[model samples]
Each structure stands twice: as structure tokens, then as C-alpha cells.
Target: MKKFTSIKLAIAAACLAASSAQADTILGLYAGAQYWQVEPEGQFGSSDDQQAAFNYDDDAQGSFYVALEHPVPLIPNIKIRQTQLEVAGSQNMSFNFNGTAFDGKVSTEADLSNTDLTLYYEVLDNGLASLDFGVTVKSLDGEIMVMDDDGTSEMQELTGYVPMGYLAAQVGLPLTGLSLYGDVSVLSIGDHSLTDYQAGIAYAFVDNIAVDISAQLGYRSFKLELDDLDGIHSDLEFSGAYAGLEVHF
Candidate 1:
């Protein structure tokens, strides 16, 4: 089994190298990585009316994405992004999580890592401006745990899929190697809603025939409000500034 997995990885690496070599001719490949310094705020609970506040410290998170675009007639481009969202803190108040009640001081940990898969069509792509319209499906596999002073604990697992609308736009400044870009994904269904947005400026420090590299500085905000999805209910927000690098070929 190990040898078979190694062979599959080798084949995949070879195909990726070949694709990178010819990406400029028939494919537009983009890859980016970012470091975000975010602060978490809000409350979480198993039921909407019964909740516990989160007192978390600020943390730095990492994210990365890869996208492939082609000129095929009605097919949309695809992009995949992975993000890390985990926080730990202590809560001093008494609360009930699920059916277990906790008193006095307790340690809390929550992990809400997610992945976004987007399929978008370029509505316009000129030298000066670009726009894309798409749909995104975000999957979350997360959990929250709280431990009391007596070593007793309760954990609630959260897993769900959310469908959202995606929109991205970019505009370039003539005679300058700078551009402004932003994207947003939003969904609202009944008592639940999610909104994630980012706006940034990019400087194309290295532009060539083979590849273009850019440095980015931006701010991002994510708001999640849940109403009993996967036996969890919460309202959380993560917002902060980020720095990143992007490469296109």
C-alpha cells in the first residue's frame, strides 16, 4: 500500500510539472499563500438561547489556494482554498453545553477549519479590469470542547456544507504595477447566515513572460451565525489584516 501511494504521488508530481511548463500557453494557473492575524469574538452554544461567551486570544492563521483557468468554451474555472481556524481560551462563567453543565472556570477549545471550492466564469477580462461570477461550496468539519475544573468535559461536533454566491473583481491602474481586488461570498438561509469578504491591493513586482509575481496587503472579515446546524448554534466573527504573495502563469 505504501509503494502504491508513492507511485501515485510521483505520477501526480510529474503531471504538475508538465502543466506548469505549458501553463502560459493554454492554461492560466494561479497560486497564493497568506498569513492572517485575526482576533475572534462571539458566543457559542448547543442551543440558540443557551450560550457561552468566547474569550480567546488573537492568533495567526495560514491559508493557501490554487486555481486553474482554461479557455474551454462553456466550462468554468476551478479554485480550491484551505483555511485554518482554531482558538483556545478560558471561560469563567457557568454554562451548559449540549446537556452537560459546567460551573466555575473551564478551558475551552474550538476548531472551525474549512475548505472552499469555487467554480467561476470570467465575465470580463480586459487589461484594465476583470470580473468573475461563480458559486462556492464551503465545507466545515469542526468541533468545540469545554472542560470543567473537575476534569469533566463535553464536546459538540459540527459538520455541514454551505452553498454561497461568489463574486470577484479587480481593476488595474494604468502605467503602474498596482491593482485593487476583492471578493465576497455570502449566504443567507432562514435563521442562518455566513459572510466572508476580503479587499486588498496587489503590486506586481515581478512580471515576465513565464510568470507574474505579486505582493498583497489586505483585510479580511468572516462572520458566521448558526441556528442549530449539526447540533450547534453560535455567532462568531473573525476579522483582521493579512499579507500574502501570489503567482500567476
Candidate 2:
């Protein structure tokens, strides 16, 4: 009788262990598509004799994310994890300018894109709500063009790469078959600065199928140094609306 009782107790303990493991954490795969519209608010240089004009058109952007998370053993109330996220986007712009009475117009275009790999940890995770904080290292690439609008100038293009750091926060809430999420991030690149803010909602029809829609706003400012000319400082700001999809596994 004692042996049988011991066997039953062992079975109960095993079931409890499995239940605890299932409750402890989760891992997920995610992907999405985003649309971005960038507008330039300021000029690169200031010279009454050198007048400049810019024209920008919007573009579509997309990205993917994979995440793994578990509740801390020592502090079960808090969740800790690591996440890998990557995003890329591009912009096309035209510039026109004239200096030294050499009446000229320049057609210029640039591509601004970056990829971010980050580690994120969450402080709160209930079935309905959660909060996350993290940092990311970003790789940036940019291009610029200069031309004569009067068809009498040569075309010049400049390209370079830079590294930047970002701090981000996100909050999520679930409602019915849909989940609402919002995120904000601040970035520092050399002497330049960028701020990004976004908020949106998502719907999950099943465990692995979902769609997300959001709106994003961004602002950037930096100083420009040109050869054989006085150093110029400028500020650029842009705001836009975006709609995207999200898939989870």
C-alpha cells in the first residue's frame, strides 16, 4: 500500500512540474509591412545668393521580428528576454539650387535606410497587458545628389555609413480578438539626433495569424560642414501615417 501511494504522489508531482513549465514562458516569431512618408522641413545651407529647393515623395517600408521571453525564476512577477528585430526603408528627394549667377537647377535624390538588432526585457506580462524596454545598435546608410536644373550642370552623388544608438519602450494590451500596441524610441547619431514615436492596434485571428496597423512620426536635426564655405546648421522634421500587418508563431 505504501509503495502504491508513493507512485501516485510521483505522478502528481510530474504533472505539476509540466504545468509549471508551460506557465513559465513563451517564444514567438513576428513579421510586418510598414508605409513611411518623410518630409524635409529645412535647407542644408543659408545664402541669399544660393537658393535651394527640395521635393520629396513617400515610400513603402517593411520589416520582421523574432522574440523569446520567460519569467524570471527569482522574480516571477517580472519577465526578462532577448529580441532580434530588423527594419529597412527608403526615401527619394529632389534638390534645386543656384549660386554665382550661374542660373542652375539640380535634381537630387537620397535613400535613407537602417537595420537594428536589439535586446529587450519586459517588466510586466499579463495575458491582457505588458511593457517592454530595450536598446538597439543601428547601421545607417544615406545618399545625396546635386545637379543643375537648367540642364547645364553635372550630377554629383555622396554616400556614407554611420552607427547610432537607440532607446525604446513598448506597451501592449489585448482586446477581444485584437491587441493594441504602442512604441517610442530616441536615437543619437554622431552629432545628429532622431526621435521616433508610433502607436497602433493589431488583430490575432489565430495563434499564428494576425494583422497590425499603426501611425509613425519622426524628427531629425544635424549640422552640415561644406568645403570652402561657412559651416551651416539645419533642422529637419517629418510626420506621417502608416498601416502594417503582424504575424506571430
Candidate 3:
């Protein structure tokens, strides 16, 4: 009788342990690369010495990000997702005077980069559809260089904080271990605002390794403050493509 009671108690304890493991939360980590481009629009300058036209070009910018997500018990089939990104790049700008390029180097190079941190609640699981709504805090730090016709130059560095809110949604469909997804985000920084949209597809070959290809379209309009140059301001617009990989554990 004593042996039977001990055996029953051990079985009950094992079942309880298994149930606890099933209720434990799981976390996911994602890291990837991004390509970015920038183009400016709108007018710059006040009355005298004012110009309405400008030209600019961007090669390809690189960026990266990490995200964390977990399920919410109050809302069935819903989770919360948060992410942060670091981006950097350079661009060339030129000013045109009545179809003649200015003898002076009106062009500038910018080492503009920023980090974005966001928190949002996501709904829909089962790998079919998901929606996220949240707010983002941005920290920007960079320098812009302006050159003169005689090849002389000066540098201006800017560092500040900005806040913005965003919403993102994604839908997935599977075909031969591959899935397609789409996302969009809108941000407001000072007097400037931007809307970014992207669509992509990923292939999962083994379980922990995956390859993704995505294209991005963006629209932006912002005002900037500059020193040493009177009546200085800017309006920018850009779009591009990106491809990267993800590892899950």
C-alpha cells in the first residue's frame, strides 16, 4: 500500500510540471539589414536670394533592427510587439541657377543616422494575419558638410529627440515553406512627417534559417534649421528596395 501511494504522487507531480511548461511564454528575436534612399522636395529660403529648385542623389544606405514579442492573456490570440532600428547613409545635393550649375559647390554630404524604438499591441496569430498599434521615440545624431566654390567648407552637427506614433499590419500566405508579408509605418518628427510602406516574401528552408526579399516605398516632407547659411530649410522624399535574412532559436 505504501509503494502504490508513492508511485501515484510521482505521476501527479510530473503532470503538473508538464502543464506549467505549456503555459510558459516564448520569446522571438529578429535581426536584418535595410537599404534606404533620400530625395528632398518643397521650397527653401525666404524673399531675397531665395531658390525654389534643387537636385540630389543617393547611392544605397544600410540599416538594421531587432524586435521582441509576446502574447497577451487578456486578449485572445493577440500579442505585443516592440522593435528598435539603427540607420545610416550619405547623399549629394546640388543647386541650379537658371539652368547653369553654380560655380560654387552648393552640394553637401550628410552622415544622418537615427535610432527608433517602438511599442505596440498586435492582434491575430496562427501565422495568418497580424495588426500592431504603438508609439515610437526617436533619437537623431549626425553632421552635414557644406562646401564653398573655392573648395573651402564648414560642418554642422545636429543631435535631438523626436516622438511619433505608428500602426502596422501584416498578412501571410504559405507556399512550399515560403511566406509573403507586408507592412507600413507613419512617423512625425518636429515639423516633418513621413509614411513608409513595404512588401516582402520569405523562404524557410530548414526551421531556424530564412531568406527574405522586400521593396520599400516612402514619402516625406520636413523643415530643417541650419546655421551660417541664411534662410536655410529642406523638404525630402525617397523610396528603395531591401533584402536580408533571419535566424530563429
Cα error, residue 138 of model 3, in Å, equals: 2.1
Model 2 stretches with alpha carbons more than 4 Å out = 1-26, 37-40, 45-53, 68-103, 150-175, 188-191, 208-234
Better lDDT candidate (1, 2) = 1
lDDT of 3 at 184: 50
List pairs with backbone clashes in candidate 2. 105-148, 105-149, 106-147, 106-149
Give all candidates' CA lDDT scores. 0.91, 0.43, 0.49
Question: Relative to the unseen true structure, what is the C-alpha lDDT of residue 102 in candidate 1, on a scale of 0 to 100?
Answer: 89
TM-score of candidate 1 relative to the true fold: 0.89
State each model's C-alpha RMSD to the native. Answer: 11.0, 8.6, 8.4
lDDT of 1 by residue, 12-55 (tens): 98897777656654789999999999899998888988878868
Question: Over 4 Å off in model 1, which ranges?
Answer: 1-25
Model 1 residue 6 CA deviation (Å) reads 53
- Residue 38 displacement (Å), model 3: 6.3
Instruction: Please provide, for model 3 over 1-249, each residue's C-alpha lDDT reduced to its tens digit, 9 standing for 90 to 100.
Output: 999999999999888766654433444445555544444333332322444333445445555666666565543222222222222222234444223333443655555466667666665555566677776655667655555455655555656655556566655555555565665556654545555455666665554223233333333222343222332344434444455555443
Which ten-residue region of model 2 has the weakest summed lDDT?
78-87
TM-score of 3: 0.61
- Name the best candidate (by TM-score): 1
Report the error of model 2 at residue 158, Å.
7.7
Give the Å shift of residue 18 in candidate 1: 22
